[model samples]
Target: MKSLWLSQAGLDTLDNTVALCPNCHRKMHSLNLEEDIIKLRDKVKNYNYK
Candidate 1:
């Protein structure tokens, strides 16, 4: 899972969490990619109005 603790987005909230595959999760941390962080934040927001 991609942890939101150090994320630029909100923490400990339904709209700030998501499950990610192992490889994808590892790559995100290793790369420290800002784009990936943005994507993850956007992905979590999908739950906002649901």
Candidate 2:
């Protein structure tokens, strides 16, 4: 698994960690935007079923 969020000071807590697939991990890192990553998080958190 790869991390969605990383920090220079280091994130040593589970709250700041997200497990991402290899491709998505690469894409997220490539995009390198916290807001975009956060949007993804929101989508996952707010997913709905119909």
Candidate 3:
């Protein structure tokens, strides 16, 4: 959700958010994965738009 704009499209609802362990969450954020977020955001937006 925070990684991408999933929150803006209601895609960040509980049904969609994943449960991550603390370590994993930290690792993911530490990577600064903007490209991944952008790609995922676009993919989900496309899927939802259809």
Residue-level lDDT of model 3, residues 1-50, one tens digit each, is 34433434646565466455887556556774878556655666676523
> For model 1, how does the per-residue alpha-carbon lDDT over 1-50 read when each residue is reduced to its tens digit?
55555366547785455688999878887897999978877776675663
- Off by more than 4 A, model 2: 1-4, 33-35, 44-50
Instruction: Please give, for residues 1-50, the per-residue lDDT of candidate 2 as tens digits.
Output: 33434554556787666677898888877877778777887876686737
- The superposed Cα distance between candidate 1 and the true structure at residue 2, in angstroms, equals 14
Superior candidate under lDDT, 2 versus 3: 2
lDDT of 2 at 17: 64
Clashes of each: 0, 0, 0
Global fold similarity of model 2 (TM-score): 0.53
Candidate closer to the true structure by lDDT (higher is better), 1 or 3:
1
- Return the number of clashes found in candidate 3: 0
What's the TM-score of each model vs. the native?
0.57, 0.53, 0.38
Most accurate candidate by lDDT: 1
**Model 2: how far residue 15 lies from native, Å:** 0.2
Mark the 10 consecutive residues where model 2 has the least summed lDDT. Answer: 1-10
